[model samples]
Target: MLIMKPRILNGMMICGTESEMRYCDIGELHKDFHLGTNTTIDFIMDQYDSGFLLELCRRTAQIVYKDIYQQLQQGNSAVLIEHLQYYLDREGGVFDIKTVQDEISVNVSKCPMLSHITSNGETLSPNIGDFLSDFYGSWGENTPFIISVDYTYPEESYCIYIRRYYAS
Candidate 1:
């Protein structure tokens, strides 16, 4: 008898040689921090201020994009969005970016982090989504054009990110 592995096996994709790092490692850290798992995810994000979380996102993005915030300051919304999409894809994210004048959106069918964590038989702390939300939100706030990362419903795995740029 042979048992074949499914492509979408739970948590199997994480912590493997094929991928850069085991996303489940973060979950383990959260556990070691004495935080409960498999629940409490929503409470965390709701408690944190969106602006503050977004600020963190901005700082992190600066490092990843190599100070491309300079271009963002020049009101290059499309360029920033394009760069972000590339980075996300390279990092194992599955999504497509759609851009309209002064507005861009990411239609994500599979969120790599969440999928891996759930696959590994663990629950995300509330902080996880909060981190992601603020990060995306912060990305919107970076450009000279005022941008907003809009979260789509049902706000879970198959979520949508809409970033709107109001060019000043």
Candidate 2:
């Protein structure tokens, strides 16, 4: 039996067949529309259009990496130290700010499709790792293909969104 996997990160959701995964950014496109980044984009494709969604995912990453990667590369000791301090304070994983920055330096096409098979009526919620564990069933023997980011917004309700890409 084939298994299914899904990964979400950084406000992007990529899913669908292995051969042709679809990536999307519902929130970014919404903001882009309001900002008139491209007035003609709407006439070309609506939110439901997978192509439009994928484009948003690609474009958003371009914007993010371009804006942040270089600043990290500058070796501005103060800024890097500040970020390192914050990560350490939070008990996050050990990571060098510059190294992390380098991961997202180049564009990557990370797909977020939740599973390999969509049979039955079982639609896995993005929050359920158990549902996705199937993709990693071989004790990490197989290539790691899916991941998710869990975040809590201070003073706001809990929400789970698939992080579409990982810099690492």
Candidate 3:
């Protein structure tokens, strides 16, 4: 059961699959295909726990960090922020960033995935916290500057994504 908003966003064709796939403008890879929030969460819950997801993300992020860590340092830490924005924006997520001294504060008013799922009547999985936190923690692995991340769960307000980096 794909739960889609009444409107579909802009997207190009995705080739090379068992069948041809179509992407919603606001999806990550295949995260938001024809499915809405509840369906996706149910799918995730069926497959893995929050800790498992976090460990998966941790190992994945570590690999990605190792491969691009040096390239990221070659220019600016803001590059990582830009990439983050790019992925989230792809799904029409709302986020704001404030930078002062060496810290980056990201306020996520509406997350494209979790928030979207919640909107569609899905209760968040218990493992969701581990998934979010460890994913952020993995970014600390290989940085030219020491980086610390703090994540706040979305409550009455929303979750916050904060990154503190030692500036070179």
TM-score of each: 0.53, 0.20, 0.59
Tens digit of per-residue lDDT, candidate 2, span 11-98: 4554322322222222222222222322333333443453553455444433333322233234222332333233232332233222
Output candidate 3 Cα RMSD: 9.1
Q: Which lDDT value does model 2 have at 88?
A: 33
| Higher-ranked by lDDT: 1 or 2 | 1
**Candidate order (lDDT):** 3, 1, 2
The reply for model 3, stretches above 4 Å from the true place, is 1-52, 64-68, 72-75, 144-168
| Candidate 1 residue-wise lDDT, 1-168, digit = tens | 112222333644432222222121211223222223223344435666656555656677555654455566665554555555544564467887776764566766666556556656666655665565655555545455444444443344544454444545
Off by over 4 Å in 1: 1-55, 63-66, 152-168
Report every candidate's CA lDDT: 0.50, 0.28, 0.52
Worst 10 residues of 2 by lDDT: 102-111
Best by lDDT: 3
Alpha-carbon RMSD to native, per candidate = 10.0, 18.4, 9.1
Task: List candidate 2 segments past 4 Å from native.
Answer: 1-48, 69-148, 151-168
Q: Who wins the TM-score comparison?
A: 3
Supply candidate 2's per-residue lDDT for 14: 41
